[model samples]
Target: MNKRIDVKEAVLEANRLILHTEDSLSEIKGSMNAKGQMLVDSDQLAFIYLLETDEDFIYAGLPHTIWSKLKEALDKSLPVLLKINDSEVELVQIIDELQYLIDNIKGNANYGEEMETKVTEVFS
Candidate 1:
C-alpha cells in the first residue's frame, strides 16, 4: 500500500539522518578535542535544527533509550552559545553531543546494530 511505502521511505530517511548526525557529532568532537574548541556557526546550528524538526526524524520510532539520550543531549546543547577565542561557539551543545556519541559508541556492543534492528522490527 502507499502508506506502507511512505512509512518505509520515512524510516530510511530517518535512519540516514540519524547516521549523519552521529557522524557529524563525532567529527565535531574530534575537532574540538584536537583544537581545544571549535566554532559553531549558523550553518551548523541550522543542521541541528533540521534534524530536530524534520518530520521523518520525529516519527522514526527510535528506541526509547537512544531517543532519550539524543533528546537530553540536544536539550542541553541547543539553547546556549558562548563566545570563545573570537568565535561564537556552542560549547554546551558540542559537549553534550560529544558525550552522547561517546557514551553510545562505548556502551553498545554493536553500535549501529540496534538502530537497524529497530527499523527492521518496525517494518516487519
Candidate 2:
C-alpha cells in the first residue's frame, strides 16, 4: 500500500520556508545598507545563486567567497565607525541575520529533500 501525502500542506510549508528565507535576506540587505555596505549587482546575483543552490550546505554559511567579500567590506567600515564613535549595532544585526539565513537555508534544503522523497514514493 502507498502512503498519501497532503499536497496542500506540502505547498503551504514550502511557501512558508521561501517567505522566511526571503525576509531574512531582505533584513540582511537592509542592515547592510544602513551600515553603509552597499551590495552591487554581482552581489545580487550571488543572492540568486544562494537561493537556487545547495552551496549553503557545502559552506555551512554564506559561501566563503561571498562571505569573505562581505566581511572585508564590514571590516573596513567597522573600524572607521568605531574610531568616530559611530554605532555598530546595524552591522552586528547584519551578521546575525546572515547567520539566521544560513540556518534557514539549511532547513530548506532538508525540506526540499523530504519533498523529493515524498514525490518519488507517491509516483513510484
Candidate 3:
C-alpha cells in the first residue's frame, strides 16, 4: 500500500537529496578541468517529483517558479549552460535555487513544531 507522505519526512528526504547532490557536484567538480563546463547531471522530472507532494507520493514537476527556471534552461538544452553576470545561465545558481526550495519545505515542516508549542500554551 502507498503510505501517505508525512510533510516532515518529505522535508527530510529533500534535505538528503540536497546533500547528495552537493557531494556529487563536488566530486564532479574535482574531476573536471577548470576550462570545462560543469553541466547538471540530473533528471529534472524526478527532482520535480521530490519537491512537489501529494497525499500518497511526491508528484511530477516542481512549483511554478522553479519549474519555469528549469524549463527555461531545458529549452536551451539539458545540462544547463553555466553563465556569469548577464552572459548565460549558471549551473551553480540553479543548484542554489533548488537548495532554497528544499529549505523552504523544511521550514514548512517546522510548522508542526510551532503548532505543538501553541497547543501546549493553550492547554497548559
Candidate 4:
C-alpha cells in the first residue's frame, strides 16, 4: 500500500513538472521570435515533437498565425496536434552549456551552435 501511494505521488509530480516545463518552453520560443523580430522580419516558429501518445504526432507551440498556416496543410481527417512548449528548467541547462562554449571560444564572439537537439526535444 505504501509503495503504491509513493508511486502515485511520483506520477503526479512528474505530470506537474512536465506541465511547468512546457509552459516555460513556450515562453522561450515566443521570446526568441520577438527578439529576432528586432533584427529582421521574423516569422513564428513551427514545432514538431514526437510523443508516445496513440496518435504519435504532437504539434503545438505555434502562435495563432503559424498554426493557421499549417491548418491548410493538414487534411480534414488528420489527428489533432497538441502544442507543447517551454521548459525553463531544461532550457537553462542547455543554454548555460551553449553560453559556456561561447565564452570559451577564442577571440570571435560570433560563435554559433545548432540548438536543434534541444529544439527537437523542446517540441518533443
Candidate 5:
C-alpha cells in the first residue's frame, strides 16, 4: 500500500545523505585541529551517528578509532556512547549517512528520484 511512497522518500533521502557526507568529508579533510595538525582524531568526531546493521556490519565512513569503538561495543552487546567534537556541519553529514543506512537496512529500494522520472518517461 504505502510501501511505494516510503521507498521513494527513502531513496531521495539517501541521495541527500550521500551528498551531505561527501561535502562534510571534503570540508573536514581541509580543516585542522587545535594543535595545527590535520583532523585525524576519529576517536572523536564533531558529531557521530549510530545505526544498527542488518548484519554485523559497521559503518565504514567513520574514522578507524571510532569505528573500532563502535565495533567493540557491538561485539560486546553494549550500547555505544559516541563522543562529540566541534564540527557542526560534519555532524549533520554523519547523521544523514546514518539515516541512509537505516533506510537501506530496512529493505527500501535505493532508486533515487530520477527513477520516478524514468518510469514516467517509459509510460508516456
Candidate 6:
C-alpha cells in the first residue's frame, strides 16, 4: 500500500522538479528575460527555485535532446523546491550542499553577493 505522504514533503517534492530542470533554471536566469521569468543566482550555488507561483515553470536550459531524457529521469526523482529569495529547500532532499555537507565546508553562500551580481542583473 502507498504510504500517506507528509503534507510538507508533498509540496517540496513538487518543487524539486525545478532542480531536474536546472538547465531550464539556468536558461531562465542566464539568458534573455522572458515576459514572466526570474533569474536564479548561480555562478555561486544552485540556491533558488525562482518559480514563485504555480503558474511559473522552471525553464531547463539543456538542449531538447538532453532535456527530453532528463525530464523523464527528474520526474521519477524526489521533488524539492528551494525558493530563490525566501523559501527554504532542505539540501538533503535536493542534494548534498557541499559547503553545508562537509564539517569544514566554507560558510560563504554569497547569496547577497550573487544576487547583486548575476540574479540582480536580470531581476533588478
> Which candidate has the top score in TM-score?
2
Q: Worst lDDT window (10 residues) for model 5?
A: 1-10
Every model: Cα RMSD to truth: 16.8, 18.9, 16.6, 18.0, 18.2, 16.4
Over 1-124, each residue of candidate 3 has an lDDT whose tens digit, in order, gives 1211111111112112211121112111212211221121122212332221122222122322243444434344434332212222223344444444434434353435443333233222
Tens-digit lDDT string for candidate 5 (71-101): 3333343422212233322222333343343
Identify the superior model by TM-score, candidate 5 or candidate 6: 5
Which residue pairs show backbone clashes in model 3?
83-89
Cα lDDT, all candidates:
0.28, 0.25, 0.28, 0.24, 0.26, 0.29
Question: Per-residue error at 86 for model 3, in Å?
Answer: 6.9
Superposed by TM-score, candidate 5 places the C-alpha of residue 118 at a distance from the truth, in angstroms, of 34
Q: How far off is residue 122 in model 2, in Å? A: 34
lDDT per residue for candidate 2 within 8-65, as digits (tens), equals: 1101121121111111221122222122221112222222111111212111122222
Better of 2 and 3 by lDDT: 3
Give the RMSD in angstroms, all C-alphas superposed, for model 2.
18.9
- TM-score of each model, paired residue for residue: 0.19, 0.24, 0.20, 0.17, 0.21, 0.18
Give model 5's TM-score versus the native structure: 0.21
Residue 41, candidate 5: how far off, in angstroms?
A: 16
State residue 80's C-alpha deviation in candidate 3, in Å: 3.5
lDDT of 4 by residue, 30-67 (tens): 22211111010113222322222232222223322232
Error of 1 at 35 (Å): 21
Query: Using alpha carbons, what is the TM-score of model 2?
Result: 0.24
Better of 2 and 4 by TM-score: 2
Writing each residue's lDDT as its tens digit, candidate 6 over 1-124 gives 1111111112224334332221223223322222222223344322332222233443312222222222343445544343333333332332222212221222335444543343223212
Clashing residue pairs in candidate 4 (N, C-alpha, C atoms within 3 angstroms): 21-86, 22-85, 24-86, 25-86, 25-87, 26-85, 26-86, 60-83
